[model samples]
Target: MSWTVDEVMTRQVVTVRPATPYKELVALMSRHAIGALPVVDLVDSDGRLVGMVSGTDLLAKERAAAGARRASRARAEQAKAHAETAGELMTSPVVTARAGDALARAARIMHRARVRHLPVVDATGRLVGILSRGDLLKPYLRSDESIRHEVATEVLGRLMDLPPDAVEVSVDEGLVTLRGELETSSAGDVAVRLASAVEGVVGVRNRLGYRLDASDPRMPPLPGARGLPAAEWGR
Candidate 1:
């Protein structure tokens, strides 16, 4: 499925000014549970996404601050050293992604770039929103497919290392119903194994609780495949 960076991007961004005090940056990250933030020039620039800083970078600064505080140097020297300029540590020219790109492509770019987050930019290169690995992971982990067939095929192919066409599959996410007739009854267990492997799959309500009636269809009297007795199954 296609997704605009804006569609999935985190717009309510937390940011810091280049001159922000070290203690305040630490507080922002801890309180918000955010891994990183955009470092802008002025508080109100709200322009293009510029430099960025991550928790790791902040921790390094914290360590330096602590070391400086503990140094036997003059008290006034320690205070002067404690103040840090954001430009020294911040990564510049924020890595970005286009809003119109496919979700999978976005993820691939992030992986190749080794960046946890990417700012979304428009054609003119102005910051519109920000995309993070967390945003992409959210949809994948919460995926809710509506067809048991689709879910079974996809999940089985992934877990069992089997081709999609090799297995019969069906699924209904709403009501969480799963029903399908496997070519081999033993494969029923295999199907359940596959379903459980998906990140979003909570539980498998397999109607396949019991095995199918494996009957011979070569008999001349039988119409075709035999399930129940003709009367019970309604010929």
Candidate 2:
């Protein structure tokens, strides 16, 4: 069964307001060791999430804003005076999650959208919890031997079209290593790609030998090639 996002979401989410000062925002994020802060504003007497302030966004603006202030005494004092509010720099139309979303799906969304914090909300849109990639990685980072083996086997299954008895999957600690002759170089890539996709497969050592064929079906790693449509390993 797919894992639910809320099952793994970080419950203690740090947030800030739109009107919060830049220095204050930075201090809060730094204190909590967080990359993003949800921007909360009032709506009908209830706190609502209007946007989010992220470390990346703050840095992007700070480089330009800070330079202008350093050039003159007046501007230096004005850094606080005219500092842009979260309303100005924050990303709006927040990307949110439900209590039951699959963790894999949430990771995919986070990856594709380039987001770090995903707030979890109930059906009524009230906030419940938050999720981050770091939180998602924690469990897998601490798994034991049997758990690691099962996970490694699952990852290898996704990566290659293994001949029924050709390849072996083994996981020691958090390492997922693929063993066996791949019959081609591209299969090595397949193994790497698949192993990396799983949540907790930390280090991947490709001991599997790859096969090559210029004229046959087995593929070479052409710069833009993907493991799509199945690259034949030996035949």
Clash number by candidate, in order? 8, 3
Per-residue error for 88 in candidate 2, Å, reads 2.1
Worst 10 residues of 1 by lDDT: 219-228
Task: After superposing candidate 2 on the true structure, give the runs of residues whose Cα lies further than 4 Å from its correct spot.
Answer: 66-83, 142-235
Q: Give lDDT for model 2.
A: 0.69
TM-score of 1: 0.52
Give per-residue CA lDDT, model 1, range 119-144, as digits (tens): 77788766667788878866444446
Q: For this target, which candidate reaches the highest lDDT against the unseen true structure?
A: 2
Q: Return the TM-score for candidate 2, rounded to 2 decimals.
A: 0.54
Tens-digit lDDT track of model 2 for 1-235: 2468876887777877778877788898889888888887754547777777888667756665565434543433344334477766677788887889888788888888789888887887666788888867765765646444554455445434465456666677768776787655665777677665666567777777655553455554453245543434523
TM-score of every prediction relative to native: 0.52, 0.54
Each model's lDDT comes to 0.62, 0.69
